[model samples]
Target chain A: MYKLSISDKAFNVLNYGFLSFVLALTFYPLIYVLSASISDPAAVSSGNMWLWPVDITFEGYRKVFENNAIWTGYRNTIFYTVLGTLLHLCILLPCAWALSRKELMAKKAILWVILFTMLFNGGLIPTYLVIKSLGMLNTVWAIVVPNVVGAWAILVARAFFQQNVPDQLVEAAKIDGASDFHIFFKMVIPLSAPIIAVMALFHAVGLWNQYFNALIYLTDQDMYPLQIILREILILQEVGGDSAAGAVGQTENLLEQAKTAELIKYAVIIVSALPLLIVYPFLQRFFVKGVLIGSVKE
Target chain B: MELSRVQVPSTVRRETRFHKIKKRFLKSWQLYVFLLPALLYFIIYHYVPMYGVQIAFKDYFVTQGVWGSPWVGFDHFLRFFDSYYFWRLLINTLLINLYQLALFPLPIILALSINELRLGVFKKWSQTITYAPHFISVVVVVGMIVAFLDPQNGLINNIIVAVGGEPIDFLTSPVWFKHIFVWSGVWQQLGWGAIIYLAALAGVNPELHEAAKVDGATRLQRIWHVNIPAILPTIIVLLILNMGNFMAIGFEKVLLMQNSLNLSSSSVIQTFVYKSGLLEGQYSFAAAIGLFDSMINIILLVTMNQLAKKTSDNSLW
Candidate 1:
C-alpha cells in the first residue's frame, strides 16, 4: 500500500476539526436549552447557567404543565396530526399508486396538470379565499383538508411504487383472479411499508409543526395547536393565564413573573420539539431515502 | 378490404387507437375510482384557487363574489408597483433569497467533508447532531432566537458582557434581521440539505478514487478532481431548484421572526400578502401582489430551467 502524504494527513486533521466544530456548534444550543429548562428561573435569567443546569429545579416544567391552554393546544395538535396525516395518506397513496400504473387512462395529461401546480400555484390569498368560500373558516376542516395531497409527495410515492412494485407482480395477481383493489390492499401496501413510513413521518412532522395554518384559520383559542400556544408564551409574551394569578404584589411580583416566563419559554421549546427530535434520529435513514427518491427524476 | 387495410388512413388509425384506449380504460376502472377523490381534491383546493386568482384583476367583494366582482383591469397591479413599500418588500425578499443562494455551496461543502470522514460512530454522531435542528419547529427555533438574543439577560448578551462587549439586541435590529433569518435557516437546514449531496456522493464510483490514488493525488486533490466533478450535475440541479423557489421564501419563519422593530428588513412579499389580505382585509390588492409574486417565481423557474438545459443539460424537466 502507498504511504499517506504529509499534506493528506494535514488535510484529514483539518477536515475532522471542522466537522467537530460544526457538531459542537449545532449541539451546544440544544444542550443549553435543555439545561436552562430545568434550571431555576432566576439562575437562568441571571446568566449563571450556560452549558449545564444550575440551581436545578422542575419549576418551569411545573408551570408549563399547569397551564390549561398548553394542554388544550397539545390535545388539539395531536388531533390535527393524526387526522391530517391519515387523510393525507388516504388521498395521496392511492392517487400515487394509480398514477404509477401503466394502465391508467390520460396518465400524461393528469400528470402534467398535477406537475403544473408545483411550478405555479394560486398563491396564498386565493387559496385562503377558496377555503373561506367553502365555509371551512375557524374549523378543523380548514386545517386538515387544504393540504391533504402534495405534488412532491405524489411524485415520491409514485416513484417508490414504480421502482418497487413490478408490473409483472400485478399482472400475475390479476391472472390469479385478484382484483385491482385486492392487489393494492394485499400486495402493494405490504411492499410499500418503507415509503409509507417515510411519507407518514414527513406528513406527521409537518402537521405537528404546523402553526401558520392554525394562526390564520382558527381564531378560537381552544382550537389552537401547541405551536400557537408556544408562540403566545414565548414570542408574544402573553403567558397570562393561571400562571399569572399569583403576580398580584406589584413590580417585584411582575419581575418574578417575567423571569418565570423566560424559564417556561425554554421548557416549552424543549417540550414541543422533544418528540420529533427524539424520533427523528431513529428514523433518519428512511427520511434520507425519501429525499433521495424525490430528487431522482423519473 | 386487404388493400384498404394495407393503406389505412389516419382516421382509421385514430379510431382503432381509441378502441385500444377504451379496452384498457374498461380494465382499469378501479384505478380511476381510486383517483377520484384526489382528482376532486385538486379541483377544489388547487384549481379553484387558480380560478379565484382572477379576483386580482377585479374589485372583489364578498357580496359580489369572485366572478361577480367588476373588473378593474391593472389598477391593483399599478397601485402595488407605485406603492412605497413595493421596492422595500421586493428588495428584502430578493436579498434574503440571494443571501440564501450565496450560502448554497455550504451544504455541498458539508457533505464533502462529512463524506471524507471514515465511516464510524463519530461520523454518524456528527450527522445526527447537525440534523436534529431541522426537526425543531419554526416557532420553537424563533423562540430560542428571541430568548438567546434578549438584551438584558440573554445567553449571547451574557457572553458579550463576559468578553467586555456591548449587548446586541439581534431580533430588534434592522441590520441583523436578514442575517438572523438566513443564518438560523442555514443552521436548521444545513445537515438536512447535505443529505441530498451525501446521497449523490455515495453514488460516486469507487474506482475513480482508486485511480486518483494510484496517480499519487493527495486526498484533497482526489476530492476536488473526482468527487466534485461527479456531483456537479446534482449541484446544478439543486441550485436550479433553489432558483426556481427564489421568491417563495419561507414565509412562516419570516413571519414569526417579524416584529415592528425589524419590519423594515423582515417584511417580505409573502408576509406582506398575508398581512394585507388576511389581517388588513385588502383581498383584491393582496391577491394582486400574490399573483405578481407567483408570476415572478414561475418566470424564474422556467428561465432557470431553460438556462440549465442549455448550459449543463441538467434541467428539472
Candidate 2:
C-alpha cells in the first residue's frame, strides 16, 4: 500500500469534501421543493419553509389532486407514454436486430442514411410543416410518430443486439430447420429483454418529460400532458384548473389566491415528478446500463 | 490479343453487379423486411422534413402549398442574414455556448472525485443523489428553480438576506441569466454526464495504476497520468460533439426560464425560430434562419470531426 503523505491526505480530504458538497448540492433543491410543497401557504409565501416543512399543510397536494385538468393531463401522458414506447420498440427493435445481423446486406448503407439525419436535421420549422402537411396536428400520433426514429436509440439497440445475442444461436436455430422469422421471434426477442427494458424506460421517461411536443402540436386543453399542465401552474399561473377548486370556497381574496398559486407550484413540481422519483431507484442500475449502452459503442 | 479477349464487356460487368445485388437481396430479404418499418419511418418523418427544407427558399404560403409556392431563391435567408437581430441572437448563443463549454469539464472532474472516495457508502449515496435530478421533468426542474429563486420567499434570497446581502432578482436580470442557465444545467446534468466518463474510467487498466503506486506517485498524480489518459478518447469525442452542437441549446428549459426582463440574454436562434415560425406564422423566414443554423452546425460538426481525427484519431465519423 502507498503511504499517505500530508499532501496526499489533503487531496483525499478535498476529494471527499467536494463530493459531500455535490451530494448536498444535488439533493438540497429537491428537498426544498418537497418541504415547500407541504408547508403552509402563508409560510411558503413568506419564505419560511426550509430543510423541513414549516407549519405542515397539504393545501398544495389537495389543490393538485382536485384539478380535473391535472387528471386529464395524467391520463393523456400515460396514454402517450405506453403507446409511444410500444410503437418506438415495435419500429426500433426489429430494425436494430436486422442491422446487428452480420449477414444483413448493406447494413452500413442503411445506417449511413440514419446517421445522416443525426448530423443534419432540416431544423424545427420544416419538421413542423411536414407534420402540418400530414394533418397530424392535435393528434396523439403527432407526438408519438414524429419522435419514433432516434438515431442514438437505433445505434444503441443495434450494438446491444450485436453484443448480447450471439450469431451462433441463430446459426444453431437455422441448423434445426427454423426459419428466419421463427428464429427472430423465438430466439432473438426473448434474449432482447434487457435492451427492450432499457428502450422502454428511456422512451417512457422521455414521454413523461414531454411537453414541447404538446406545446407545438396540440392546442386542445384535453390533449395536454401532465408536464404541459404543470407548466401552466408553474409558469403561467393559470389556476382555473382543478387544483384550485378547493382553494375556491374558502376565500376569493387576491392575497389568498396568490398564496395558493405559489403553494400549488411546489406541489405541482413534486406531484409531476413523483412517479419517476418513485420508480427510478429500483431502475437506477438499468438506467446506468442503458445510458452506457447508448453512449459507449464498445 | 489474349488480354483483350479476357476483358469483360461493360454491359456484362453491370449485369453481374446487378445480379450480385439481387442475389444478396434475396438471401437477406427477411432482414430487409424487418428494417422496412424503420426505413419507412425515417423516410416519412425525417426525409420528408428535409424535402420541406426547400420551402425556406420558396415564398411559402399555406394556401399555395409547398409545390405551388413561388421560388424566392435566397430572399428569406438574405432577410434573416441582413437583420440586426441576427448578430444579437448569434452572439447570445455563442456566449452561452462558450460559457457552457468552459464548464463542460466539471462532470469529468466530478467523476474523478467520486472515483477517489474510499468510503463506499458515501460514494454510492453521492452518485444516487446526483443522478436523481436528471430524471425530473424540465417543468419540475424549472419550477424548482422558480421556487428556490423567488425574490420574496425563495430559499436563495432568504439565505442571501440572512447573510446580509441584497436579494437580487436572479431570473429577471440579464446579468444573472447565463449564470443561472448554465449553473442550473450543470447541476441537472452533472451526475448523468459523469456516467459516460465513469464508464470510461472503469475501463482504465488496473496495472497502470498499480505501476504508478509502485513508483510512489501520489493519488492525484495517478489520476492525472492513468485515469485521464484512459478516458481521453471519450472526453475528446464528447467535446467534439458538444462543439458541434454549440447552437442547439435545449429550447424547452430556456423557453420556460425566459421572461421579457431576461429576453436580451435568453433569446437564441431556436427561441427566435419558435417565435417567428410557430407563434407569429412567418414560416418561410423562420425556416430560412433555421436552415442557416443547421448549415452552420453541419459545418462545425464536420470541421470538428476532421480536426479531432487529425489530432487524436478519435472522431465520430
Candidate 3:
C-alpha cells in the first residue's frame, strides 16, 4: 500500500548507496586481514597483496599449531569460559528471582547491598588482594570467580522476570500448596527462558572475549588465555621479535613468524567469536525482546 | 493468597531457644537459601579482598600478607599525588572520556536516521553490516586498523598517494590516538547502541506521524517533534548512565592499540593498575589508584542520579 515519492525514491537509492559504501569500508579491512594472513610472507612484506590474497599458503596456521603456548592458551581460555558461565548463571538466576520477590524479609536491604556493588567497588588492586588473600591468585578460580555475577546480567534477568512472570502464577502455585522453590521452579523459570538465553549469550560472549582478568591474575605462560598470547605475539613482532636484535640461531624465520602471528590472530578471533555469532542469529528474537523488556521503563 | 488461610496463635509465648531458632529458620529459609550462592560469591570474591584494601595504606610484602604488611598511613596516596605522571594520566583520562561523551549522541542520531528510512530491507541490511564489526575481537579490530593505516603499503595510504598527499602514520602519533580509539569504537558500536533508540522509536505512536504528514510537516520535522521527544527519556537515562561510567573505559581496546610511541596518550588508570599491581607486584599502591578511580566513578554516578531525579523523575534508583 506504500507509494514512494520521486524524491523519496532518489533518497532511498542514495541511502542504499551510502550504506553499501559504509559497509564496504567496515568490512574491507577485515577481509584484507584474512587474505593477508594467508598470503605468502614475502609477498605480504613486499606489499604486493591488497584486496585479494597472493601466493596463498597454510604455513601460517601450521606454525601457529606448532607453538605449544597457543594450545595452552586455548585450553585455559575454554576452561575459564565454560566454568565462568556456569558459575555466573547459577549465582544470577536465583538471586534475581529472590530479589524480584517482595515478601522476603530483608529483601530491600539485600537488593541495596547488591546494587551498591553495581554502583561502586574497590578497584583492581583491592580486588586482586582479596583474591590473593583467598589464595586464588595464579589459579583458574582467580580468572573465573571474581566476575561470575555481572550486575547488568542480573538486572536484565530481574526485569525479564518482573515483566513476564505474573504474580498470579506464583500465587496459584502457592495456593496448590507449592513451596516458594516449587513455585519458582514450576512457574517463574519456565517463563524466563528467553531472558536466560539472552543472558547466556551475553555472558558467553563476554567470557570468550575476556583477556584482562587472565592478564592480571595468571602469570604462568601455560595458563595464559588466547588474547594474551596474541598480545605477546603482536608485541614480539613490533619489537622485531627475538631474532632481529642479533640473537643467534632462533630457528623461527621472521617472515614465517609474522605470517603465523597474523593468521593466528584472525583464527583465534574467529574461533573465540564464532560460537556467539552463530548463537546470535537463532537467539535474535529473544535478544530483541529481552532488550525491549529491560529498556521499556526508560 | 494462601497465607490468608493460616491461623495465627494469639498466645505470644516466649518459646524455648530451639523452637525459636526453628521458627525463624522456617520463615526465612527460602530467603537465606536463595541468597546463599551470591553471598558465598561476595564473601570469596568481594568481601575477602575488601580486607586487602588496607595494603593501600601499608607497605605490602607478598610474604607478609594483609595483616603482616606494616601500615605506611597514606604514603602510597601521597606518592601518587606527587608523582610526575599523575597530571598526565589524569588529564589524558579526562580528555579521552570527554571525547567519548561528545561522541555519545552519534549512535542515537544514526538510529533515528535509520528509523526514518522507509525502505525496510535496506535499513535491516545497513544495521546488520554496522553491527557486525562490534563482535570482532579488539585484537583483530586493532590489527585491521594497523594494516589499513600502515604507511608503507596500506590501502588507506595507497589512496593517499593517489590523491598526492603523503601517507600519515596514524597509530604512532599521540595526537591521533584518542581520535582513532573513540571513532573506531563509535563505528563498531553505533548499530548495537542504536538498538535502544530503535525500540524507543517503535514505541512511538503511528497516528502522530500520520497527523504530522497531514499537517504538511516534513519528515525531518516530524522526527524532530515526535520521534525525538518520544525517545527523550531513554536518551536522558542513557546519558546519566554514560556519564556515570565515563571513567571506566574498557581497557582492552586501549591496551591493544597502545605502542611505545602512543603510550603517553594511552596509559589510563586501568593499564597503570595492571602493570603496577600484577606485573610489578605493587598490589597495595595499584589498589589505592584503582580505589581512587572507582570512588570518582561512584561520585559521578550518585551526583548524576541525584541531578536526574531533580531535573526529571527518571533515575537508576
lDDT of 1: 0.88
lDDT of 2 by residue, A58-145 (tens): 8778877887888889999999999999999999988988988888766667888888888887788988988887889999998799
**lDDT, candidate 1, A1-298, per-residue tens:** 7677899889999999999899888999999999999998778777899889998898889888898888899999999999999999999989999999988867887887777778877788988988887889999999999888888999999998998998999999999999889999999999999999999999999999989999989998889999998888888876755655564676766666566577698888888899898888899998888888989876
Cα lDDT tens digits for candidate 3, B1-317: 00112122333465685586567668547857877898667655555555566678888887777778898998888888899988888888899899999988888877877887766777777676666666666765676677667677666787787778988998899999999999888777877788889888988999998998778666667778999999988998998889888788867788788889988999888778778888888888888888778778888888998999999988877
TM-score (all chains, Cα) for each model = 0.95, 0.94, 0.88
Clashing pairs in 2: A63-A243, A67-A242, A67-A243
Candidate that scores best on lDDT: 1
Model 3 clash tally? 1
lDDT of all predictions, in order shown?
A: 0.88, 0.84, 0.73
Expressed as tens digits, the lDDT of each residue in B267-291 for candidate 1 is 9999999999999999999999999
DockQ category of candidate 1: medium
Question: In terms of docking quality, how is candidate 3 classified?
Answer: acceptable
Selected candidate, larger TM-score, 1 vs 2: 1
Ranking of all predicted structures according to TM-score, beginning with the best and ending with the worst: 1, 2, 3
- Give the least accurate 10-residue stretch of model 3 chain A, judged by summed lDDT: A237-246
lDDT score for residue B248 of model 1: 85
